[model samples]
Target: MSVLLEVQGVTKTFGGVVANQSVSIEVRAGEIAGLIGPNGSGKTTLFNSIVGAHAIDEGSIKFEGEEISTFRVPVIARKGMLRTFQQTRIYGEMTALENMRISAPEARVSALSLLGGFSSKTDTRGEELLEFVGLASKRFLRAGALSFGQQKLLEFAMALMSEPKLLLLDEPTAGINPTLINGLIDRLKQANKELGVTLLVIEHNMRVIMNLAERITCLAHGEVLASGTPDEVRNDPRVVDAYLGAG
Candidate 1:
């Protein structure tokens, strides 16, 4: 498989607090890699640094063999690297179709032109995308009117609008019901299989991460405790010490 993302000696510090300490990892094309750690292990901070939300005090980040440590968030996103937030950010007043249309880069012109109303083409694409996330029946409803799981699905669909090659998802299945969580996993798997999009997920749910990630990276106090296949990492003594305890 082709390498899509590389991080070398990445470190970020906030005065006395070290957020990420000499971290390094790579994500290959068409793979789902899960990152797990305790609450303050710097998983989110490292993600923020990668996406330009925070600057790296040291190290470099590369995408498709090109150095992108200095690029801004929009530049990185335009380069086919996208990051989704742990918290879903959708327009409450907008309909499900409208929400997808807003982030659809290719649909921008048609969407803006139909500011008065949605055109048939826009409606179709939006509806299709909604259907992709099992939200087709809710297309006409307001985004905020949907349940937490539906909103999460909408957020994923909106990210798809960017046509990303590498997707950074922070806690994608968090705050959702168990039934809907499985659906989210299946959708992500389908995206990876059909679209060949690479995924790097930061999820706390052990079972979810284990089932989805081909390789799992465990972080502890801003350091890598273990990195391996789900089975290996799950049985790792250090990883267990860091996150799971003897049981």
Candidate 2:
């Protein structure tokens, strides 16, 4: 597989505290990769630096062979490296369809125009995205009114509005019912298969990660403890010692 992104010696620090330490990882095109770690292991910090949510104090980030460490959040997002937070960031007052419109970067019309009323182009795009996420029936409902699972799906749809190439999902299945978990996973799989989008997921849900990820990277205490296939990671002594054992 082709390399989609590369992180080399990436490190982040806030004052005297180091959040990430010489971390290096890679994602391949058209593959679902997993990043698993204990809390405060720098999983999210590494992801933030990659997506320009946080700037690295040292090291470099390359996407598709081009350096993007200096790019801002919007700049990186425009380049097709998009990320979603663990929390669903949806416009609560707006209908699901309208919430999707809010995330449509292509809608260059005035924000005041939207406050008054949205354009046909934005409305159409919103509906299309809602349909894409299996929320077409709920399109007219307020985002806050929908069940948590539905809201999560809505957020996923909005993130996909930019037509991202590499999607970084932060703990996507953190808090949801088992029934909805499968639905979310199915949508992610479809996104990868149908849209040809690569994915890097940070998840603590071992079953979900093992089922979906092509490869897994394990981190502990701000360092990569192991990197391998699911089976390999499951059996690694270091991984067991660092993460899988009884606490």
Candidate 3:
């Protein structure tokens, strides 16, 4: 598989604190890659840097062989790359369908236009995605009224509405129950396989990531400690001592 997203010697700092230090990794096209680390290990910081949630202190981020380290979120998103937060970012007062419509790449042109009305194409896609995430019945319900797991599903669908080429997901199963997590995992796999979207996921749930990702990269103390296939990373003594052991 050819490389789709690449991060080389990336670093980020907050005041005196070094959140990420010279990290490098790659995600190939049409593959699921996992990022894992202990608490405060700069997992989310790396995600933010990749998505342009903020600027990096150093290094390069490339998507589809193009430099994007300096690009803003909207710019990167328009290039068919997008990210979902650990916390679901949905409009609470709006219906799920409304949230989906507003999340479209075109909706950023004018909030008023989105609020006023959407074309039939947008409406049809919104409802289809809602059903895709198994939230068809809740499409008309207020976003905030949905359960945490449901909210995450809604956020996933919203991201899908943009037809991204690569998606960076931050702890997708974080707050979900075991049963829901299984369902979510299935949906995530479906999204990757059926929709042909590439995924780079940050997750603390070992079982989930092991099953979901084709390759895994482990970070500790703001640096990559190990990276390989699931079994290789899982058995690596360094990874075990640094992250899996502590977990």
Query: What Cα-based lDDT does every candidate model obtain?
Result: 0.86, 0.86, 0.92
Output the lDDT of residue 177, model 3: 82
Quality of model 1 by C-alpha lDDT:
0.86
For candidate 1, the per-residue lDDT at 230 reads 98
lDDT of 1 by residue, 1-247 (tens): 8888998999899999998899998898889999999999999998988888767999999999999988888878878888888888788899888888767655444535555654576567677778999999998899999998789889898888667899999999999898888888998999899877899999999989998999999988898888999999999989888765544
Give candidate 3's TM-score: 0.94
lDDT of 3 by residue, 118-208 (tens): 6899889999999988999999999999998899999999999988999999999989889888888888899999999999999999999
Ranking by TM-score: 3, 1, 2
lDDT by residue (tens digit), candidate 2, 128-196:
878877899999898999987778788889888767899999998877788778878888898899889
What are the root-mean-square deviations of the candidates from the true structure over C-alphas? Answer: 2.7, 2.8, 2.1
Q: Top model by lDDT, which number? A: 3
- Which runs of model 2 end up more than 4 angstroms from their true locations? 108-125, 245-247
Angstrom error of the Cα, residue 83, model 1: value is 1.3
Query: lDDT: which is higher, 2 or 3?
Result: 3
lDDT of 3 at 152: 93
Each prediction's TM-score against the native? 0.92, 0.90, 0.94
